[model samples]
Target: MSSPHPRLSARQPRYMIVAQALMHDIETGRHGVGSLLPTEAELGQQFNVSRHTVREAIRRLTDLGLVSAQAGVGTRVRAQRPVNHYALTAEGLSDLFRYAHEVALRIDSQEEIVADGALAAFLECPPGQKWLRLQGERFVRNEGESIGLAEIHVAASYRAALEDTNRPDAAIYALIERRFGVEVREVRQEISALALTAAQAKRLGVAPGSPGLRLVRKYYSSSGELFEVASNIHPADRFSYASTLRLRPTGESEN
Candidate 1:
């Protein structure tokens, strides 16, 4: 008989396997939005694991926002949306672009605009200065449903760099880096709850007041000057952000 696959690592448990199986069921249409999962006791017996183990597995899925539980009504499946595991760090900087290109998403628009107050203040530029604006909508290639939208603005000095390649699918940073030898060395980000503006909703084709993700970013060059400001809107069903924090001793220097 073939040897059974070795048990999962002692660190994270087989929660990943359980999570995967559940995801497959959801993906293949066996279970769908609002579908309820078997009870904890039933799931433990089904997976041949203890109730505690089952609870951990369920918690893993919950953290990803794929499942919800009611006190007595069992866990129900949430809308099956893209589970984008991303880091708000330099290493993961290319994820948004990757999502657009790899998914064969269509870009909606790209242009240059003069910044008004909020945009001017955010980019630390004076009002009416020319700023390169890249506005685009991305949707699943075959599905044809709008997945998200990105509004990116950068210094107009990079205008020539974007001469003819400003498509909905263009990578703004790539063009700047290639032409002006400017690399986006670091990105600082802050996330907050933002209600969609009427125009924002119309551009994205979503109802006004629909939940969305507000990703505000400042991109810095090697010299540490902030040169780009962007606000990306992701529908509540389209994304989830993840991060980890480590605590240090109180008296230790953060050097």
Candidate 2:
């Protein structure tokens, strides 16, 4: 086995620290692709942790596409570096807000525009309405690679709400609410499949014509007024959205 890694700080979870150390070993080639990692018991002994902790660490590696584990077979290093796979499990509006907090947006450009016929149709607003459009890439917090490109349009009245776009801690809609006291009562979302254009592929670091997903969300206020429209494009390989559906009890009426 390789030399034991130095002790990690207690600030983070134990499994995460163990996972980080193992990931470092893989990236440094100490654990080559196709080679089996140290057994759970061995890892536990080396890290002075429980076998359960070691297992959880390996699970984290598996989630990142770095390693694979099979019954009766040791975990094998699948890749030298972590794959940038982002999965969002949205069950409610709060979950959507949580997703926004998990990803940081880096705005590339901004402009004030009057919605033309086509743009107005997309935004579900009347033609000639003014909007503040912001374009950006969304990254997993503290990671370098971007997972998606985002285009957001805010009603020109709330343009001032975005004055602190640099703040990654709050969602844009939340900012609008805090600034203008307009509550977002509903969010309508649509997902569509598309082949990425060359320009989009260049910005997203994917091949032209790659399969992708476009997600558009329309935010509405309590009075049934649309205030914001946001769209995000994600490479098929990098992002997945999941939702849970529960079956109603028997005899439950559709109405």
Best by lDDT: 2
TM-scores for all predictions: 0.64, 0.69
lDDT of 2 by residue, 183-246 (tens): 9898898889999999999998766998999988899999999998889999876788898878
lDDT at position 234, candidate 2:
93
Best model per TM-score: 2
Error of 2 at 70 (Å): 22
| lDDT measured at residue 10 in model 2 versus the true structure, 0 to 100 | 74
Evaluated against the true structure, the overall lDDT of model 2 is 0.87
Cα deviation of 89, candidate 1, in Å: 5.3
lDDT of each: 0.68, 0.87
**Model 2: residues with Cα > 4 Å off, grouped in runs:** 1-80, 250-255
